[model samples]
Target: MDDTPTTTRPPRWLNDHEMRAWLGYRRMRALLDLQLARRLAADQGLSEPDYDVLTSLSDAEDHRIRLSELADRMLWSKSRLSHHVTRMQQRGLVTRQECASDGRGAFIVLTNHGMATLHAAAPDHVAAVREHFIDLLTEDQLRILGDLTDTVLAHLREQPA
Candidate 1:
């Protein structure tokens, strides 16, 4: 404390209005995430992470992606994804296949059952998302949200990795 120096030319901090807005956004985001998780858990017996993996597989070119690539896309650590995949494979929701092109690389391929479950859950999941978030917002608000998210993502991407 004795060695610390105070600066008069510091960066501008968020003002009262900005603070309120930022906090409101944070609270709403947290609540909405909880609501979505609860809804999905109750309706489909799937956790958010479970649904994320299933949905990613459903959208992939052939319901499959390389294990490492899947982990990267999901922003999960390799060990975590591997363990999750192992559990899912045991559940018969997905299977691992050796990559012919690369002996070290394996693919997490979603089974037909997994695809079916995701397909069945999609409508309900989307409806819940809409009811809880999108339906309440006006088109302009949605556009602004999209823009805000894009801006934030871009800014985050610019940071040192």
Candidate 2:
């Protein structure tokens, strides 16, 4: 082994303002997610993942999307999406159809029941979001938040997987 001495650089720590902003953002994200999840479960008998999948499928052409594509869009692993899809299939919310052109590929299709569930949940979810988060922000704050999130997301997307 070579005997080159490595010099370690110290991390640039967050200052008070940055620390406060970071911590506040973390806390807000956690609480907002929890509140939204609770409201979805209590009002619609839907978990966040369930709602997410349903909404995604609902937005797709013919209410169907390729499994792999859906998994990528949802940021879920193939195995996890398969398991969740199995559960959704059991509940009659979704069904999988074998792709005609590719034997190994399948499409996730939203059933009528799933669409109905999403329709029922949308109004209450929007109300809850407005009440808990959106209503708390001024117009300028909302615009800034949107810009901030967009910038962060763009940076993250550029990084290696």
Candidate 3:
């Protein structure tokens, strides 16, 4: 081992094999996202964020959920959710309500227009998902992936930033 005084900074280390694996993961994810985004944009005029909100609302009871809950589900900060919601509200896609239980608590309510948009978007979104991602994976692979992702997500959630 040559004792060249390396800088005090910790070296960022990854073996050649590890680096290739990581690069492959990143490239596939980016490419898939790009393809999905383009398909959605062309077919439904839904941005990824817009689709996220729509899907979150669609999965909630009565197609409505609390604003903070929506933010959590979208993995978005409250301010970012607020800004997006404000724009959606302007488009008559959603509305906000003061929670009856808590004066400070607010709920994000999906309007009829929002539901309509989601319905219209669903087919193309599924087709895109199937074509670009799902169709490539076996059912077993999909299940294993879901399990692995959930495990990783749990670990990340437990770590303090």
lDDT by residue (tens digit), candidate 2, 76-149: 99889999999999999999999999999999999999999999999999999999999999999999999999
Clashing pairs in 3: none
Question: What are the per-model numbers of colliding residue pairs?
Answer: 0, 0, 0
Query: By summed lDDT, which 10 consecutive residues of candidate 1 come out lowest?
Result: 1-10
Off by more than 4 A, model 1: 1-11
Tell me each candidate's RMSD, in Å, in order: 2.6, 0.9, 4.4
Candidate 1, 18-85: lDDT as tens digits:
99999999999999999999988898877788889998888888989998888988889889999999
Worst 10 residues of 3 by lDDT: 3-12
Candidate 2 accuracy as TM-score: 0.97
Give the Cα error of residue 49 in candidate 3, in Å: 1.0
Candidate 2 segments whose C-alpha is farther than 4 A from its true place: none
Pairs that collide in candidate 1 are none
Ranking by lDDT: 2, 1, 3
Worst 10 contiguous positions by lDDT, candidate 2: 70-79
lDDT of each: 0.90, 0.96, 0.89
TM-score, structure 1 vs. true: 0.89
2 against 3, candidate with superior lDDT: 2
Winner by TM-score: 2
